[model samples]
Target: MPYKPQSEPGKTAYQPDVQITRLGEKIGDPVVPADFPHHILRFRNDRWDQSIGLHSLNDEEWLSHFGKFEPLADNLYPPLALRYHGHQFRQYNPEIGDGRGFLFAQMRDHEKRLMDLGTKGSGTTPWSRTGDGRLTLKGAVREILATEMLEALGVNTSKTFSVVETGEELSRGDEPSPTRSAVMTRLNHGHIRIGTFQRIAYEKNEALMLQLVEYCLEQYYGGVQTDDPAAELFAKVAQEVAKLAGAYMTAGFVHGVLNTDNINITGESFDYGPWRFTPYWEPGFTAAYFDHEGLYCFARQPEALHWNLAQLASALRLIADSEPLVAALEGFPKAYGTAFTQHFCWRLGVESRGFDEDRDLVVAAEKGLAEKTIQIDRFFFDWGRAENLAGLDENYAAFSEFSTLIADRERSRQPVSSYWQQSGPCSMHIEEVESIWDAIADDDNWKILSKKINDIRAMGIALRIG
Candidate 1:
C-alpha cells in the first residue's frame, strides 16, 4: 500500500464545522482530531487531566474541542497572539511562520498554570516553504519520550498532550527515501522563538517589532508594564533566556542546534533536534552529528546563549540602549550558576555549605571512572557502588552493537563516566569528595538515583547508563 496525502489541509469537508485558525491570525478555532487524518484515543471519562487524559475521540464526537459542536461558539484558543522572526541555520530567511504547527487553544491545567494547546505536524500552511509540512510517526514517538524523559530529569520543557498520526504520507528529503508524517499536540505557554525577533530585526520592521514587544509584555512578562516597552521587553527577554541557559547546563542535556529559529522567544527549549544528554562532560562534545564546528557544543551552550541574547538585544535596539541590554546579559551566568548548583546538590543528595573540598573528591572519582569509559547514567546510578561496581569496565559493551548509529570513536568506550565532575576547579578539597561519597553510600540515596533513571525511561526517552 502506498501513501496518500490529504487533498486539502486544514479543510475538513466531512466535518466542515471543525474551525481553522492561521498562525498570527486572531485565534479562530479549536483543532478537532477527526477533521484531519488523525487516529483518536477518546477521553478517559475518569481522569485527572482533561486535555492530557483525552482518548482519541470518535469521528462523530471530535468536533467538540474545536468549537464546532455548536454554531457561533467562541473558539477555545490561546489569548496571546505571537509575533517573531529569525534566520534558520544562519541563513536569512524571513518567510517562516508557525508553518506546520499552531496554537490549538489555551487552557488552565490541574495546577492552575496557563498553558496553550499546540499542534505539531498539523499540515502545510502559508509558511511551509518548499517542504511538504507533515510530521512522521517517528517524531510523535520521539516527542512523547522527550517530554517524559526531560520532565523526569527535572528539565523545564514542553509537555506532550497527544500524538495524532495522520494516516497520510508526505515527501521529505530529510526522511528515509520516501516519508510518512505525524503530528504532536504539545502544551506550552508560548511557541514564540528568538528567531521570530531576529526575523523582524533583519527586515527592520520596527512597527511589527513593537507589536511583538507589547504582546510579550502582556503574555509572558505580565509583571512588567509597557510604558517604555522596548527597553523593558528586551531586558525581560534577556533575563528569561539567562535563566533558561542555566537550566540547560544543569540538566546535562545538549540541544545540539541552538539556531535563533529553534530558540523559543519565551526562553524555553522549543524544537528538540540532534539533542542528547551528556553522560560525561566534554566541553567539545556535541549532540548533532552534522555539527562539526561544535558551535553549540556541550561546553559552549552558555556562550551560544549569550550570542543569541545579543541578537535579541539588537532587535530591541529600536527602543532600548545597548548598555542595559548588555548588562542584562551579565545576570545569566550568576542566575544559571545558582540554579545549576541547587539542582546539582539535590541530585547528589548532599546538604552542605556551598563550595566544599569534598566536591573535589567527587570530581576525582568521576574522572577516574571516565578514564575507564564508564557510561554517564550508569556511573551515577551506581555511584554508591564505586567500591563494588564489578562490570564498570565493561558496562557499555552492549552499545557496540549500535556503533553504526554513532560516529564518535569514544562511543565505543565501555562504562562511560559521569560528566558531573569534569568541570570542577583544580583545587578541589578532599573533604568535599568524601562527603559526596558518604551520601552516595547510603541506600536511601541509591533508591532515589535508581528511581530517577527509571522515571526517565518510563517518560519515553531511553538513556544509556553503563
Candidate 2:
C-alpha cells in the first residue's frame, strides 16, 4: 500500500541546531524558480518520518517546507550552503561546495540523533561555477532507487524523503537532451565529509581543524571518549566506513565515485551517482562510464575507500599526533574483513562459521557464482535458506560443505517467507532503469516506477526477515 499523508496535523517536532559555526559567507538564500510548479511524486515515507518526529505534517505543510524551501517554524532561515574543499577524481579542487544543494534544516530524531534535511537541484549557489545547478528528473529517480535498494540491503544509507518535479527542461550531454528537472530532499545523519576536514587542513588552520574534530565527535560519536578525541574519532569513522565498504561488496554495489568529498564522516552512503548493482559476480564491474582506469570498480571499492580514509588521516595530522592516527588507519583491513564475512552470512541467511571459515565461505561463494555465471541476487535469494537447496552441480560443490552445516542447523526450522520464491529478485540494472525513465520521458506514465518501488520494498522486508 502507498504511504498515506498525515491527516490530523499537530505541533511539529522541529529543533534546529545549526552546528556548523563558520557560516559567515557559506550560507545562501534559495533562488525560487520563475515558473516552477511543485508536484509531489512520492510524499509519504510515514515510517521514516516518524523516526524524525515529522509524521504530524500534512501535505500542504510538507510542500511548504520541502517543496517551497521554506524554513521550518524555528529552524535556520535562508538555508546554508556548506563550504568545503575536495579531491575530485584524485585531483585537489578547492572550488567545490554546495553548488546545487544546501543544508535546509537540522532536527533531532526520536533517538535524539541529529539529522539534516539537505536538498539537491534547489537552485544555483556561489559555488555553481559556470554550470547550472539543476538536477535532471531521471537523476532524481536513480537516486531514489539507489537509496531504497541500499537501505533494503542493510547498508547505512540516506533515505529519499521527498521528490518534487520542478517544471524545467535541462540539457545534458549524458542522457537525452532537454531532460526534465526536479528537486529532491534527503533525510540523512550527517553531511560532514572527509573533504570537509581537508578544507581546514589546506589552510593549515590547526585550531579550526581541532574544533571541527571535536564538533564531529560530539555530534556523531557522543559515546566516544574525549581524551585523545581526534584519534578516537578517526578510528571510529574508519571502522564504520570499513563496514560500509563491506556492505557494498555484499550487495554487489559500485558507488562509482568514492572521492574524499563523497565519503561521509558518518559512514552512511549518500550522493548516489552512476551507481550500479552487478548482475553477476564480476570484480571489474565499473559503474561510472568516465572511470577509464577503473579506480572505483566493484573490486577496488575497499582500496579506494582505504585511500580516502588515509587522506582523512593525513588531514587530521594537523590536529593530532601521527602515531595514534596511524594506529587507527591500521585497523581498517581487519574491520573490513570481519564486516564482509558477517554481512555475507546475513545475505545468505546462514549462521557464520567463525571468521576464518566465514571468509573461506565468502570466497567459495564468489568463485562458484563467477564460474557458473549465476545471477548475484538470484544466488543469494534462492540460497538464503539452506533447506531451499536441491540438486547440487559441480559449480555448487565449493559451497557444499558449508551448506551441509547450514542444513543441519536448519533441519527442523520453519521456512521464512520471501518474495524471491514467488518472483525473480528485484534488480535495478542500467537497462531496466532506462526503460522506466523512457516511459516517463515518452508517455509521462509513473505506474511502472511506483510498482517497482513497491516491489523493491517488499524484497527489503524479506531480506530483513531472512
Candidate 3:
C-alpha cells in the first residue's frame, strides 16, 4: 500500500513566507531565489496522513498557519546556493551542488539551537544539468524509516520534517519502473559537504574556498578558536568526521556509500543512500547495490571515512600547510574509538570504557553466527527470553527440550552446540551467563526474568521472541 504522511497535533504551526536571497540566486535561479530553475517546486498539500500532518503543511500554508511572514528570521542565515565538486566512482566530477535541493532557511529552536530547514527533490537548478531532479517515492519512505530507527538507536542524525508527494510521475533507471516522486523537508545544521570544498579547490577559487572555511567554522565549530582559520577548519572537520565514524561503527551501521559528496561538513549523517543496519557481522555485507567492490562495507566504513576526510584536508593545502592537516588527521583513531565505545556501552546497558571492544564483540558474535545461523535481528531479539535460559542446562535437559521448538518449527536442526561452542569461550567474560542454568533451576528464575524483560522494555527496545 502507498504510505500516507500526517501532521502532529501540537506542533507550532509554521507558515513559510520565504524571502529570496541574493547569494542563493546566483547558482540556482530562484524558483524562490536566483540560480534556481523554473521547474522547481514545493510539495502538494494533503491531510489524510496521520504521521506528518502538521510538519507536511505546504510552504504557503506554513506561513499562513503560523501567522508569521517568515518561519526563519531574516538576515540570520543567508541562504546561499552552494557550488561544489566531487569524485564519483573514484573519478573526479567537478560539478555538483544542491542540484535538486537547497538551503531554504535557518532558525533557532526552543533551546536556542540553530538548525537549517532544507528541502530535497525541491526541483531543478543550474546544477541539475539535464537530469529531471526528481526524487522517487521510495527514497522518501526509506529516509523516514532510516532516521526514525537511527534515532531510536541513539545515533545523531538529521530529522525528517515533512514529505510531500509531488503528484508527479518520473522515471529513473535505478527505481522501479513508473515511479512516483516526492519532495522531502529535512532539518540539519548546514547543507555543506566536503564536496563543497573540493569544488572551489578544483576551480582554484581561493577566495571562495576561504569563505567556506570561515563559514563552516562559524556555523558548525563555534568553539575552536585558532589563528589559522584554514588549519582550524580542516582540523575541526577531520575530528568531527572521525567521531561520526566511531558512532557509525558502534551502531553496526553501514552508510554503504561514503563519497566526498556524502560527507556533510556539519558531520551530521545526511544523504541516506544505500544505508543499512547490519543483519549479521559479515564484513563484506553491503547495503548499496552499486557498491560492487564493497568499498563502504560494514568493516570498511571507518577507513573510507578517513580517506574522504584526507581528501578534504588535501584541498586545504591551498590555504594551510599539509603538516597541520596531517597532524589533525592523526587524531582520528582515538576520537573514533572513544565515540564507538560510548555508543556500544549504551546499547549493552553498561557504562562505557574509553575504547572499543568492537573487535572482540565481533569475534564473539561470529561464533554464534557460524553455529546457530541465527538471524541477526532475531538472535538479539530473543537472547533475553526465559526460553533462552531454559536452553542453558549443562546436562542439555532443558536445552534438548528447547531444541524441539527450533527442530519442529523448521528454523534449524543443528544442536545448540553449533553456535554455543563458538561463543562459549567469550561467554566466560560476561558476568551471570553461567547463572542462566542456576536461574532456570526452578520457578524463581521466571520471576527474575520477568523483571529483566520489563527493564529492557522501558529502555525502548522490545526484545520479542521470534
Q: Which candidate is the best by TM-score?
A: 2
How does model 1 score by TM-score? 0.67
C-alpha lDDT of candidate 2 relative to the true structure: 0.78
Cα displacement (angstroms), candidate 2, residue 53, comes to 2.0
- Per-residue lDDT of model 2, residues 239-269, tens digit only: 8898899999999999999999899999999
Best by lDDT: 2
Ranking by lDDT: 2, 3, 1
Write down the TM-score of every candidate. 0.67, 0.91, 0.69
Candidate 3 regions with alpha-carbon error over 4 angstroms: 1-60, 63-81, 356-466
Off by over 4 Å in 2: 1-15, 22-43, 391-415, 418-420
Rate residue 125 of model 2 by lDDT. 80
Model 3 lowest lDDT segment of ten? 1-10
Which parts of model 1 have CA positions greater than 4 angstroms off? 1-48, 51-73, 76-83, 174-179, 203-208, 225-228, 352-372, 383-454, 457-466
Query: How many angstroms is residue 286 displaced in model 2 relative to the true structure, after the best TM-score fit?
Result: 0.4
